[model samples]
Target chain A: MLDLHNLRLAENGVPHLDSITASFAPGTLTTILGRTGAGKTSLLRAIAGLAIPDAGEIRLDGADWRRLPPWKRPIAMVTQQFINYPHLPVLDNVAFPLVRRGEKWPAARDAARAMLDKVGLAAMVDRRPSQLSGGQQQRVAIARALVKKAPVLLLDEPFVNLDYKLREGLREELVEMLRTETGTTVLYASTEPREALQLGDRIMLMAEGRLLDAGDPRAIFERPATLEAAQVVNAPPINIVPLEIDTVARMGPFGTQELGALGRDLAPGRYRLGLRAGDIAPGGPHRARVILTEVSGSETVTHLDLAGLPLVMHEKSVVAHAPGSEIGISARLDRGFVFAANGALISQGASHG
Target chain B: MYRQKYLFLLPGLIALTAIILFPLIFTIRVSFSGWDVYNPGLSWAGVKNYVRLFEDTRYWSALSRLSLLAISTVLIQYVLGFALALMVWKDVHARRFFRVLFLVPMMTTPVIMSVIWRTIFHESLGPLNPLLDAIVLGGQPWLSSPGWAFAAVMIVEIWQWTPFMFLLLLAGLLSLPSEPYLAAKIDGAGPVRTFFSVTFPGLAAISVGALLIRLIEASKILDTVYVLTSGGPGEATETASYYIYIRGLRDFQIGYSAALSITYLVIMIVALTIIAKLMVRFLVKGQS
Candidate 1:
């Protein structure tokens, strides 16, 4: 097990990691889901002993990792950028760690060859890193990291640099490869919600250099503990609109009667309404103006403005909503979340079932 | 119609021909003629000077001695310079100060520095012998002895040029990407292993370039030998350049000296080209 306690680091008075405490159990892959500058890389770097925390305790398998130098730590990390020894061939790049740890040439090469074959790059073993394409180079880096068979592995958005198609392909390949290393504790950091949900056994939500929540991927997606956590784990970005619980909940453009079963029984107070992009559907009683529309893969994400409140609506397949065009929209408030004005979750809407 | 484009290159072309080609072509012509203090004018000697050069033992010995001096001094400078560069490359107190201080010797005029060094190696009167005596080593003849005079020339050469190697190697170090070092550290590589596997291999191309430049410079060693030893102690420290100067200017045998200079230039070019090829083959292509 890898454990961190009150990890705090500040660079030039800008906090990179603010009081982070987390742990990774063996055989579990935890996806640290956060947008850019959310300290995801910093957290992984601290675990790999590359970055030192100002005040923290890192213990791995009951040993103090703080006392160990990076070379002494039993860890391996694959960064977002494909980093391989340019001087070495693909085979030697993979075998480098083994050789450094006193493994003989033939044995190390054999292990490297096997790992390369697993990552689907056995044919390019003799080629240098520069000779390969971007995706292939990252595979070499991944193979090198995996060949060590280290107990703890840290992957900081390793496939994020590749094109979308390539990213998905490599992510699946990594999952298949990681499955065989059952005992290795893995920490994969990413910004995409789908990737975090697809790969991680658990998800860690981070914002502003602080980890908001960590739990089962599905549970975190369904019931994020805070508004920031929900925004981090959603793709089109969750819409946080102000809510007034008077006789009934008044939120955005949705009047009390149009709220369906959502605003029926809510405590009377001012609160924030957290609505996932999918919670807002087209062709409803209330009208919203389309601010912008984007089509990605099979889904269309549209930005909407409803009576001065900004909103995002996610639609199923290829739907064209022109900018400045008015469309009828409605909120599935039963599937949304009610939060305090301070952004703390007060109550999550019950599941449709 | 596009002939005007050629005019753009005219200035640089003219400068190249005037600065380099003119002197080179004139030397080749001079080497074939009998031009001396007595002759005073260029007169075709029918390869007589070239034939005489083949039997000149002093010139051959000087050539051999120069080769030895250049290779040994350059090799020593590379090692010492690389060490000094690594010391101040990162994580040292007053690193900026030390970097400039290391380069102090290279920036000084070579002839002037050699003059100062001559006094430093002046057996009884020099501070070096006294410092040696204080360290419990007895003082010996520094300039009067043949072997010591050759060594003195080498010492001065190494001191004057090591900074050049340091500058090139340090720039190479600074330009290397930081990611590889981080990867090496995470891979459990110790200091020695990291150096061999990462740092050394990364610097291979620059190392080849620096070595070739230093080798080319070290071959033409004249100033130190002229100031410190003056080819004394039975020509022990007489490099090819110094010997050529003796024949050309001191002895006033311009034609013979021109032939010697031409032969020396040809030999250096051939030798350095072969060395560069070998280095690239081993240090660069081998790794790749």
Candidate 2:
């Protein structure tokens, strides 16, 4: 188990992470989901002992990791950019760490070869790093980290540079491999929701260097705690629209609807309504004009202008909606969430007629 | 496309052919003829000059000594410069200062360095002798003695050229991709293993190229030896270039000097070719 208590990190006199306290369970994958510059990499670096937090205590299996140096922390970190020695052969690069520990050449070679074979790179043992492709290089890095066999493994967007097929395959392979191979505490950071959903046993949603929510993958996806969390978990991002509470009753379309008292404490003014693209039904009380449609094979993402507000909808089948076509839309309230104008979650238990 | 590119490079081609190729052909032609300063005429001498060059023990000794100097200078410069480059590459304290300091010797004029060294190495009044006398049992002649003079000349050549090696090596180190070093570090490689397995192999190309350049430069070592030894102490430090200068200027043997110059040019070209071929092979293997 890796635990961070009241972790506050600052850079250049500006706060990066403000009092983040979290624990990663052993034998489980904990993924940090955030946008670019959301302090995800910084958090991973802090855990890896590459970056030290100003005021925080990092504990590994109840032992103080904050006091230990990086080499002594029993952790291995793989950065986004593939770091492989170009001059050395693939086998030697993977075996490098053991040599420093005074292992003989033959033993180091055997250990490196075993790890490379685990990563399906045995055939390329004699080849240099530059001779390999980008994906191959990433795999080599993974193999090197695995060879170290550190208790804590920190990966920073490991599959970001890979193609879709390679990314999915590696993700599944890595998830299964980590589950079966060892009980190392893995903390993987990524901006992709699919990756987070596929690999994360527990997902932490973050935005602007602050943790928005943390829970099981299902709960985070199905019932997000904040607007940021909802947006992060949704495939095409949750569609957010501003509505006047009093106007919902006065407007002819939604006609005197209570909305299950979702945004009750909104002072009878503005509130934000969030609904996943899958929850937005085609026929409903709300009407909008289709602004754009993007067809990506089996799914079609349609952008609508509803009441002069831009909204996005993801449809299972291809919907050839023209730019000026009028569309009727409604929300599945069970899958919808309401928030105050200040971006706080109001309620997610609203019922629909 | 080829014609257009050739037209663009027409002026350079014409100048090279006229100034370089034409003179080289004329020199080769003159080398085989029995021409002298008095006659100013050419008669086919066949291999007479070549035979004389082989029989002359002084010439053979001079050639052998120059070869020794070239090899020693190249070896010392390569070792010292490579070591310095590795030290700087490892992020030593005051790396910038050391880098700049290593380059100072290379930047100084060889003639001036030789003059300074000449005074320092003087047998009686020089500072070096007194320092040696105070430290050791006896003070030996540095430039006046045949053996010491040769050693002194080689040292000056090394001092002048080691900086060139350092600059090339440093550039190579700086341009290397950081991925390999990080990979080695992550693999738990100690400082020495990392250098041999990663750093040295990465630096192979630059090292070979630098050594080849140094070899060529060492072979032509003249200014320093001229300033310091003046090819004295029984021609102890007389390089091929200095020999040509002595024959042409001092002895007034224009034909003989020109003939010897041709032979030296041919030998240098052959030596450079072999070195270049080896360097190319090393570079290719390193990349692979």
Candidate 3:
């Protein structure tokens, strides 16, 4: 396991990463998910030694890995940009990492050709990066990184420059490669929540230079450690409502909220209710007037107003509702998270009832 | 619409023909005839001026010297300037100070630089001599000797223009895509391998660009040579441009000088064409 202990990086009197501590298991693919300027890239850079930590201990199997220089470390990285050396052929580009290791030219070329073959780009080995499409160039970059055979692989938004379909297809292929390629700890950084959910075996959600939450992809999203974590992990965003509990009843726009056993024991005070879009099914006891509807991919998300407070319901089916129509919206109460007034996840959104 | 477009081009075309075409035509006319500006007799002399130009060893020597100066100055300047650029481009302390300091030489007027260097290269009493004397190397007449005079002129040229190359190359270095460098480091590439594989290849265009500008400018340079050496010490430092200046303007051998200028122009065309070809090859090497 690669363990990062209290990793803090400051630049220009401002902290880029604040007390980031996490452990990445061997041969596991983890995605660092965050919004722009949320320190996802900074955390990746720190791990790759591009930005050294201000106060931290990076240990690789109990050894101080921070002592190794960037080049000396066992690492392979693919940047977010389309990067291929403009003066070298794709074969040479793929062979570059091996050549840097003092390998002979012809041997490096053969190894690179094999690596390219793995990326399904063997025929275009002689072609330059510019001669290929954006997808092809990114494949060449990946081939270059994979050829290094580093134990640690870091990808910083590598598919952000590509088209949506390309990103999706390449991501599937990359996850497969990481699984098949043994003993490599792969960390993919991206701001797109959908991408993180699609590709990450485990997801690390970072925000404001802090690693907010981490775990299995489903667990993190279903029960984020905090309200901010819930917001970053869910696509189309989660609906948050103010809660006022007094004895056995909870006051808020969510009238039919079932906050499990904790709901009865909670002090009669203010709190926040978190509901994932997928959990708010249509039809229960509470009624809401439809405000808008958005259909994307296989799911249709309907926006509704509950007593003037807006909420959204994500349904797997392509269901449509007209504006101003009153519909019964049910919260999968157990799938609804309860947060303290200060935004900490007091009760996880699960079958606690 | 076509007529309006043509009308809009009328003034510019007229200006181009009058200001540019007329002088070129007159020069070409004078080149073919042995019409010395000193003598009033003007008649066609066939290829006599051209043949005489080929026979003149002094013109050939000047051309050779100018070529030598161009090649050596460009080579030395590129290496020194690129090294300096590399030093200041990375995380160097006081990088801004060094950047401003390096730019001082290029910012100085050529004439001013020449005069200052001339004083510095003065035989026994100059600062250079005292510095060399302190290091057990003195008593060399810098501006009085043939070889040393050429060296002094080339030195002044390099000193004045190295900063220009440095500036252009620095911009190129800074604007390079950071992805490749990051990829290089992660790939276990040492400094030398990374430079050759990534940095140098990426810099190919700027290198050729700086070389082209410096080559053309240095080949036809005359001011520094004129000020420092005055084409003296047995005509050792007489560059092609200085030769043309003396023949066409001073000696009034207008026809011969005009013919010689054509040769210089042809050489420039051929040299620039070669450089451009290299640039195209470089740019197309790893591109679509």
Candidate 4:
């Protein structure tokens, strides 16, 4: 097991990690999910010993990791940029770590070849990294890292630089390869919610240098502990609208709202409502003016203005909602999350009953 | 008209022809004549100087001696300079001060430095002899004996030119990406292994370039030899440049010396080309 306690680091008066305390059990893969500048990379680097924390205690299998140098620790890392030794062929690059660890060259090469085959780069073993495409080069780096069979493996946004199609395919291939290394502790950092949910046995959500929530992927997605955690897990961004309930429930531009069984037990004063963009469908009671629309893959993400409040809608299929055009939309308010004015989650829309 | 653009290139063309092409053509023409003290004017002497040069044992010996000196000094400079560059590359206190101090020798005038070295090498009065005596090591002939004089000249040349190697290599070391070193470190490579696998391979191209440049400069080792040794002790330390100077200027056999100069230039070109090919084959291609 790898454990960290009170990990804190700051630069130029801005925090990169603040009192982050987390642990990973053996044989578990945790996806550190966060936005850019959210300290996901910082946390992984700290684990890999590339970045030393200002104040922290890192323990790995009852050993004091803080005293060990990066080389002394049994750790392997793949950076965001595809980093392979340009002077060596793919086979040699993969075998380098093994050779450095005193393994015979022939044995090291055999191990490297097997690892390369697993990553689907068997034919390109003789090629230099510069000769390969971006995806292939990344696979070489991945092969090199995995060949170490180190107890701890860190991949800091490894597939982020590749195109979307390549990223998806590589991620799946990586999952398959990782399945065989059952004892290795893996920390994969990413900025995408869908990737985290798809890959990680556990999800760690971070925002602005603080680890907001960490648990099972489904549990965190269904009931994020904070409003910030909810915003992080939703891709098109969950719409946050003000809700004031005194004698009755009131939200958005609509004058009144029907507080169904989901709101019956809530003693709401001034609260915030978390609405997933995918839940807001076309053709509903409320009318919204489309501000802009974007087509990504086969999905359409439209920005809208409901009365005066800004909202975003995500659709499964491509749809062009012209700017300044009025459209009728219905929100699944029953499934929305109600939070206190302080950004703490008060109740899940579905779980309140 | 488009012809005007060609006119704009005239000054540079004229400068190139005068400074480079004219000297070369003039030297080739002069090599064909017998222009010496006996025959002050250029008179056609077909293949006469060339035939004489082939049999001039002293001239051939000097050429061979020069080849030995140039190659040895440059090799020593490369090793010492690379050591010094690695020393101050990083993790040192006041690196900027040490870098400038290391470059001080290359910045000084080589002739003046050679003159100073000659004074220090003075058998009885020089400070170096007394320092050796103080250490219980007796002083011997420095500029008098042939072997000692040859050693003295090489010492001066290595000291003066090693800084050039240091500067080029330090620049190369600084520009290298830090990622490879990090990778090597994480691979559990110790210091020596990391150096052989990462730092050395990373600096291969720059090392070849610095070595070639230094080799070219070291071949023309006239100033130090001229000031310190003066081809002394029965021509024991005489190099090709000093020998050519003797034949061309001292003896006033301009035509024969010009022939020697042309032959030396051709030999240097062929030799350097072969060396460059070998280096690129081994250092760069073989490294990959």
Candidate No. with top TM-score: 1
| CAPRI grade of model 2 | acceptable
Q: Score residue A101 of candidate 4 by CA lDDT.
A: 84
lDDT: which is higher, 2 or 3? 3
Q: List chain B TM-scores, each candidate.
A: 0.96, 0.89, 0.93, 0.96
Error of 2 at B52 (Å): 3.4
- Expressed as tens digits, the lDDT of each residue in A1-353 for candidate 2 is 78889998999887777788998888778899988888899898787666789998899888987876555567766788988877668888777776666787799899989888888999999998889998899998898888877778888998888887888788787776787646888899999887788788899987777888898987777677778788887778888755566645232333355665554554676666787787776888788899999997688999888777677888899888888999888866544577766777777754321
TM-score of each: 0.93, 0.82, 0.87, 0.91
Alpha-carbon lDDT, every model: 0.90, 0.79, 0.85, 0.90
- Docking band of candidate 3: acceptable
**Model 4 clashes, total count:** 0
* Superposed Cα deviation of residue B92, candidate 4 (Å): 5.0
For model 1, name the residue pairs that clash.
Answer: none
Model 3: per-residue lDDT, tens digit, A1-353? 89999999988987789999999999888999998888988887887788888899888888897867788887888888877776778998888778778898899999999989989998998887889999999999998988888888899899999887888899888887777778889999998888888888789999889888888887776668889998898877888887787755464766645577647557788888777787788878789999999987778999999998888888998888998899997876666677887788887644531
Candidate with the larger TM-score of 1 and 3? 1
* Deviation from native of the Cα of residue B233 in model 4, angstroms: 4.0
DockQ for candidate 2: 0.39
Q: Each candidate's DockQ score against the native complex? A: 0.71, 0.39, 0.48, 0.59
Quote the lDDT for A333 in model 3. Answer: 62
Model 2 off-target regions past 4 Å? Answer: A59-73, A114-118, A243-256, A261-271, A281-297, A320-328, A340-346, A350-353, B1-22, B36-40, B75-109, B116-142, B145-155, B190-197, B252-288
Q: DockQ order of candidates, best first?
A: 1, 4, 3, 2
Which prediction has the highest DockQ against the true structure? Answer: 1
